[model samples]
Target: MEDVLELYEQPYDPQQPVVCFDERPCQLIGDVRTPLPIKLGSARRVDYEYERHGMGNVFGYFDGLAQFCGRN
Candidate 1:
């Protein structure tokens, strides 16, 4: 839309900060077995099995001009 584009074209103002916010549901997972430690020539190995502990939300806020961010 023209209005949206115009908003983006405006110069940044610290006094009137513009913040963008977003959130999403995240799955909390954990490995079922202990992973093997890495050796001199070998890499660590982890099992494919995982347990879902619970669900949670991840939030993010950002201001492009001010280079500020907040998360939870």
Candidate 2:
């Protein structure tokens, strides 16, 4: 990134917006079913399990000049 920025510095303004474009896929998982109810004397609990499915692709556009752009 520094090399590219240096090369472009001659033509592109440092203060100008130099944006970066990228995309990524995110995955989500969840349990199949909730746990069964327990008897009066026994303990009862509800739990869920999750499995990963194909995630969707996300697109991002970023500029170097922006102060508050990307935050993870």
Best by TM-score: 1
lDDT of 2 at 24: 88
Using lDDT, give the best candidate's number.
1
TM-score of 2: 0.43
What residue pairs are clashing in model 2? Answer: 30-49, 30-50, 31-49, 31-50
Predicted candidate 1 versus true structure: per-residue lDDT over 1-72, tens digit per residue? 898667656777767767767999999999999999898988889999999999999999877556633321
TM-score on alpha carbons, each prediction: 0.67, 0.43
Candidate 2 RMSD to the correct structure: 6.4
**What overall lDDT goes with each candidate model?**
0.78, 0.65
Looking at model 2, report the run of 10 residues with the lowest lDDT sum: 63-72
